[model samples]
Target: MAEIAFPKDAMRVLKETSRTFYIPITFLQKELKYSVASAYLIFRAIDEIEDHADLDNVVKYEILQQVSELFERPFNNEEYFRILEPVKSIMPDVTIRLEEWLQACPMDVRPIVADAAREMAWGMAKWSKANWNIRTREDLDDYTYYVAGLVGVMLSDLWAHYADEKTDRDLAIGYGRGLQAVNILRNEEEDLGERGVSFVPDGWTRAELFEYAEENLAKADEYMKSLHKKSILLFCRLPLALAHKTLNAMKEGREKMTRAEVEQTVEEIQSE
Candidate 1:
């Protein structure tokens, strides 16, 4: 693979958006790193619109649908800018500069990333239309699949492209669900207090949700154990390790792992 410069601005936005992903991405080989970073930022851009505090559900649905339509066609800078113009002023920088992130991907894999993002945007639109109602276990599964599980499927494709590596697609979805479930747990307070949304099922408690996360994480472990590439393994393991530790911390009544604990976990992963 030829060398490609990962954009500095993309890296800066990535670090601002997600510390967990930013750390693992830095460990990937150059081309793979660029591809993964681009994909992540693409998803994060639409995700901000989906989770925006001020946007009405109807407005979110409209914007996300337009985004999905934009991804369906060939890349056009003018079209994207026009499509997003109505709410650009209110949107975050990550969401506003989505075109930059799209162009940053390795050309060969850009379509793959775009297609995955299109599906995710459409899914977000669906959930927003429904007001993000999670009434049952199946609803939770479907919601997570759209938002996060598709991410696993997309990454699996990227791995195959870059490393000639094949992963069990089912386990990959579990990997994403596990991580997303942990996020739901960690943000339960904010999700309810700020957004008035609850990802937990109709009658499920924290313990039930904990069990859900652990089950999917077991699949994530299987997915990681099957990897032969050291870089890929490290990339996958770093987040999984943190997810587990975060769950443990939550169990002990802590909202999340402290900065010191996060650094300690990274060091431990590096040592392993």
Candidate 2:
């Protein structure tokens, strides 16, 4: 085992950028908390570039490629920040000091985080160069896998690192896919209207997309059922519970969960 310290900057960025994720991550203990948070910040950096409405496609590809290249060697604080400085302000605060996050992660966990970041960055670069023309479900799956499915794999790796039980990687991937699908549906208008990107396949009805999302969420439910630790289970369950609720709400034309609904869901999950 290696020494781990929580980076205040990473915590701040995590809280600032994501509320739902911030809650479940708080349930993670010690090094696992730091590892997962650091990993998340790295992914968020890549996502910020991918989703930047103002950046040119060529610029986005170059920045993402630079990100992928940075993880290939030792973490260089100056060069990393310099290369990404153009979009640093728009990205989460944690991304501003990536090297610090790397320093805080345990040695064993650092490689997993770096590898996943490399894969995500590279994939994002590829898609950005293509302008995200997701013409089919396969294209959508490939894109989501780059941005979200890999998150499931990364969390599964973290779960394995903290506990003795092995995680089913496919189920975990499904968990990511499910959540991303819900996001695509929820943000359909914004992604298309603002970003000119449409995640839904042509000829797909809203009901069909909702069914596709639910099927994957069912896999996510199975992933949760396989976990034994209460904390880990809660960490995996809360977002998933919310995601399912979000999908149901979307069917009714709602975009988000109210605080009361979140609290009630927490109670239901805790009671089960």
Candidate 3:
């Protein structure tokens, strides 16, 4: 695989915003790494807009709608930047340079990236407009599928394109749900106290949510095992291993892993 020069600025922002993802992204090879990293930054930008706690719900909805609509028009640098300007100050630097991110996207994966971003943006708009009232297991599934499951589908497409691996769409969706459910569980306190959003269903206990996460992750495990490429397998395993470990820690009332523990996990996966 030939190395692509991933944007230094975007890499800075990526490392700045997420230490966890930074590790796995390194495991991806060549253009696949470039494509996945750009997609992640684009998606992260949408997430920043959708989850701006201080922004009015109406503003969030409008911004999300506009972002979703961006893919419909011919790609315009200035126009895209302007559309994102409302939340730019609060967004990460990677997000601020969305047009550059788009430009960096591998030509073949551009449509997949755009489509996933638009779908996620629209879903976020719909849920934001509804004020994130997750009331049932199905509602929770719907929400996770929108924000994260769609990501699974998109990644499967990218993996198929780059790695020539036939990925299972259902298992892909399950992988996303498993990771996202872990996120909701870990961030519940902050989401509820600071954002006034509760992702947990009514009458659901921690154990119930943990079970949901575990079951999805079990499918994620299968999804990983099906892949033969070492780079793709390693790239996918880091996150899944972390999510599984994190879920276990959350069950024990710990929300994060120590740096040493993270290194140990990565080493174990790499050795495997």
Candidate 4:
């Protein structure tokens, strides 16, 4: 695969959007790094639309479905611009520059990224249409599968493409779900106050949600244990460790880990 010259601003936008992911992504080797970064930015773009505070659910559904359809065919810059024109003022720069992120992927694995993105967009559309109702554990499972599990599946595919590393798909799904569950926990206040949506199922307490997250995180640990490559292990280790620590912090009545603690975790991982 040819080397990709990622836009100068890509890393900046990534850092602004997610410091946790940005750190691990930076540790990845060249082509794999680019591919993973491109995939993340692409997914994050559509995710912004799904979670937009001001947009009505109807509009969110329309835009997300349009984006999903757009990825179903060969990408046409003009088509994407036209599809998003009406919402341009409210859209974030990341969503507006979707094409750039798509093009940033290495050609060999671009299709895989696009396919995963398309599925995610469609899934987001489905939930948007439903106003993100989560009334049961099964509903939560389906929602997380779309928004997070597919991410695991996509990463597994990318790992295979980049390093010929084969992972258990089920475990990979657990890995993604584990991280996302932690996010739902950490952002529960904001999600409810700002968006008026709750990922927590009906009649479930915070403790139950923690149990749900822990179960999936256990699978994540197994997923990491199955990896033999040092780089892949390192890349996977940071987020999992942070997720574990973040959960611990939350259990202790803290919102999240402090900057010093985050840096300490990274240092320990690097030293290992």
TM-score of each: 0.97, 0.93, 0.94, 0.97
lDDT of each: 0.92, 0.83, 0.85, 0.91
Q: Model 3: per-residue lDDT, tens digit, 146-182? A: 8999998998899899878898989999999999999
Model 2 over residues 171-206: C-alpha lDDT tens digits? 988999999999888888898889888778888887
- Which regions of candidate 3 deviate over 4 angstroms? 1-5, 85-90
Candidate 4 segments exceeding 4 Å error: 1-4
In model 2, the Cα lDDT at residue 7 comes to 58
Each candidate: RMSD: 1.5, 2.0, 2.1, 1.2
Candidate 1: global Cα-lDDT? 0.92
Candidate 3, residue 52: the lDDT equals 74
Residue pairs clashing in model 3 are none
Predicted structure with the largest TM-score when compared to the true one = 4
Query: What 10-residue stretch in candidate 3 is worst by lDDT?
Result: 1-10
| After superposition, candidate 1 runs with Cα above 4 Å error | 1-5
> lDDT per residue, candidate 1, 1-272, as tens digits?
22354578899999999888998998899888998998999999999999888888998899899889989888777887787787788889998888889888988998999999999999999999999999999999999999999999999999999999999999999999999999999999999999899999999988999999999999999998778898888899999999999999999999999999999999988878
Against the hidden true structure, what lDDT does model 3 obtain? Answer: 0.85
Clashes of each: 0, 0, 0, 0
